[model samples]
Target: MEVKVTSSTILPSPTSHHSDIPLTIFDRFAANIHIYVIYAFTPPTPSNADLISALSKTLVYFPTLTANLSTDCHGRPCVSVGGPHEDRGALVVEATVLSKLEDHLPLTPSPDLRLLHPDAENPKHLLQVQLNRFQCGGLVIGLTSHHRVADGRSMCAFTIAWGKILRGVPIDPLPFYDQPWLKPRNPPLVQFDHWGSEFIHLSPQSNEFIITRTDVDPSEITNLLLHFSPDFITKLKAQTNKLSTDKHTTFETLLGYLWRKMTIARQLDDEECTTLSVSVNGRRRLQPTVPPEFFGNLVLNAYPKAKAKALIEGGAATAAGIVREGLRFIGEDYFQSFIDFGEVYGDRDLVPCFEKDGNVLSPKIEVDGWLGLGFDEVNFGGGGKLCAFLPTWVPFEGLLIFSPSLSQSGGVDVFVSLLEKHAVTMREISHSLD
Candidate 1:
């Protein structure tokens, strides 16, 4: 499993914004950490030179991708685009592996998978990419982006746009950057308990994972990839909606089932409460809803909690209801209040409140749903399209991602990190409907 680094270069955008793009409050609310996306393509993919050239041209439409992250003299974070300190660009690393791609058909999350992507520690550039070429001509494109610059949807848009440009196709929905619309209203109307829900009196502990930043070691985390077949998804949905006619979505039912499984695997006490932090996008929930194509972060978490006894004893129907109820709590008013909160207190540094009941080893799990984001449309031509897409590695405990599987069968792929012992137990019971 040796990967030889052939070249490392900083590729700048051919065009620049020539201005400092101040991050919106939504951006500020998102984690300030680097997240990776890996796309494995079968042999007959485009050459590195052609792909890189296409990327350079694509960055012209996304100046924020080429920009460096910095702060204003007032100390608020901002993206410096073609400024006095503007040599910054996306980092591209090229490497080659001696083995054939067939050895790793369905890639899973593991510590060794970290080598497939650029190192994220103290990253200089906001966006980074790695090209891992196999002897079989198969290519795995690993991309990383600082969460503040964009969200998962934005990254998908950028990747899809890059692929389209490589194939000489027009970008259907051009990237939009009308940020002033997100500004807090004049004489900002503050309406929610944001300080209690979003901000903390103490400084952040580490990079945000869902909502909890902890001192947990990466070595203790166990990463697993569980694929749910379409048939299995249908079964889970039936079980989730059996007790009620709420008609929970695939995301809700799936997440509800997972929360129950993990909770049972953890073997918590009957009275103990477990909170699941679900990522909710404020784009369509806003007053005059933000465009789905808006390229920035609008993600906030919805906290769904139930006693471990209730989640395990009450069945999938109860769990799905809890999940839906929590998500419904964060509506247009919820988003507007967050915006108003940012307007009033954004200048002063604010930390996210990690825990509610002061539980140290908090019983919280985080999840993000990445279905229907147009991942299937990312095709670089040359007889190669997306064979698979997944996270390089999940290093934190109690975090999960529900992604649409790129397999021909069309199912769901669940990538998760948990305690080693719990992960082992969860794996044994992952597919069991009981």
Candidate 2:
């Protein structure tokens, strides 16, 4: 279907929060990428004008979203908020689609998908929105936010605030923006080996040297959403719990199960070690817990490695144990050490292996769990709720995102990107689980 942009406008932050803000180390290492989330609504959708008007007012409180990103004297990323005579505002595009909304139920990366988000490279605006209206009176709201400015939780907070404003409700308890809480310790200490097995320091002549990009045929890759019903999850949990004496949380259980299944689907060599990198939110994990509303990136990766044969042959409990063990490294001390490490090495061009392009260090999978982010509760206005939520596309192979199903059946929607042949095997494994 053809989509055309009719108008573009800027929505700047409120005049009150006009000031320059420096990014934390956590923010500096963020992928410097744009994350796109698409929300669909049926007929009787909220008016685009009304949504834009609400968004403009919402930006007043979230001025950082309207800010421009630049490097400081040390060449570290920081945001210039509300500069003099500058339009520090998010870009909003009004667009229309010729076809029905169902045509793109599960959004994927394409030239058309590119229209749903702001420019991925060199995002002129930290935040951008595209209001796409289909011929059937349905609407799809697309949001593209720079990862360096906020994490998924922060993005959800912004949406929640916007929804309240659209509904004429008071935005109680404003977001906390203090960055000192995560500052490095006085005498920076390198406690645990934070970059041990999971991260590889890139060096010339090193086998793990990084690549910015690689060419792969579009036809050779497949992106699909696999649904796991609540009942199925329960049954799987029962089966897994039978193998271990300790109980496993749903997140760990599901991740372990998926990791094993993906390993089998890939049909890798038995002796090869496969790693699963899970993003752990550091907001509460830190001592003197960070405020839930504190914006910016506050996440760290937890790497759990296992031999391919063990992962495929071991019960779900064994995989879950590895995942749980990986999480144990995310306590207060570990986070403090990580911050200190960043403080000392922030200017040394320390890039995470996962951030690079081309092949990962080895056969690996990365999962981001968004099951309880409460994005589904965001109501723009009227009674419309988000009917569907998913990223526009996967950035690389072996990346999987777990999102709560829109149906609210206590199930999950797994969005996965893998090679075409492996994707077929993954689909078969998903079906067998059912």
Candidate 3:
């Protein structure tokens, strides 16, 4: 891979807030995601200067796409609010010409991204690029994004825009990023009181994954939208209402089912405790329904407890009921009060970090409504429809994803990522469901 840094543009400091204060949603989460593409070009090699120049033009409209912290400030990315320094974030476009991609490069699917490097500690800025040449005349564009500002869907939108710019076309109706709907509570409704006792951040914990050698090949993890007919989903909902009325819980039921399956796959010892978690958005849980367009991260995790032996031996419906019960706790009042978690847990000296107790298996479940907004419609100059992926895995060894699928079925698609050895166990658990 031939790689060279051509432009290293940094944004100027913002006059908006003082250094000691915590950053606002836009200040903290606003950052660009870096994407690299390995393009396989034919004999007519594209000129590096021209390619960079065309790409730069795309940034003309999206001035915030590229940027880093300026010297005047403590390296925080510049904001778009005021002064000449405002909107100074510029993309660093580098063109690397490779003689042969295959012979010279590592063929692993994932790019080498340094996660905890000292210089790369910020949550907003990410390093990335596209190698125009490879051994087989192939190109590899690697993407890295700051998880703080944008989610996977937001990052992919930018990539599609870049592709269109490369093809020399106007991006139709530039992406709308207005996020007025996610306003913080006026008095700050929820307290962060119990966060310290109940939750664990990634700091100081060895939440590292011990990768075991496996013969299983990594493949494109596609979304499998489970089509539980409306009737089926309805039945589940009914079950949930009944369970909730009895104060048993429905979310817990689902989690129990999933937790059992995951544990059975791993064949954990009978005495082990298995943990499963889910995220609840605190937006509408307040006095008002959060605006649909609200975009910042307003999530909280829910961990339901269970013994591996119990989970592995439980019936499917029984497990689902456990998860359902757990979910009922996330009602409007819970969300409304949860807003205060910051205050509740702020004094406990909990810096953000991953949790790694190693004794339990915790699986996280998240269901966001971005699919309803038609993320597929995000197009730039018609290069094509955009496809997206969430690269970062939560701390849990087992992760279950529920997202909108491209099939337009209005059904949810699920993806599970676990250790390779658990394949047989997972298959058996899945078979039971079938």
**TM-score (all chains, Cα) for each model:** 0.93, 0.91, 0.55
Residues 47-85 of candidate 2 have per-residue lDDT tens digits of: 888999999888877888988887666676678787553
Best by lDDT: 1
Give the Å shift of residue 270 in candidate 2: 0.5
The true-versus-predicted C-alpha distance at residue 400 of model 2, in Å, is: 1.0
- Which pairs of residues collide in model 2? 14-60
Ranking the candidates on lDDT from highest down gives 1, 2, 3
Residue 74 local lDDT, model 1: 73
Error of 1 at 69 (Å): 1.8
Distance from true location, Cα of 388 in model 1, Å? 1.6
Off by over 4 Å in 2: 16-19, 84-88, 102-112, 118-122, 195-215, 359-362
**Candidate 1 lDDT tens digits, 318-389:** 999999999999998888878888888888776656532221233788788888877767889989657888
TM-score of 1: 0.93
> What's the C-alpha lDDT at position 214 in model 3?
26
Query: What are the RMSD figures for all models against the true structure?
Result: 3.3, 2.8, 8.8
The lowest-lDDT stretch of 10 consecutive residues in candidate 2 is: 353-362
Work out candidate 1's RMSD over C-alphas.
3.3
Off by over 4 Å in 1: 15-17, 84-87, 202-214, 354-362
Candidate 3 matches the true fold with a TM-score of 0.55
Tens digit of lDDT per residue, candidate 3, span 152-196?
Answer: 444445656666676677667576545443444556666433334
Cα displacement (angstroms), candidate 2, residue 193, comes to 2.9
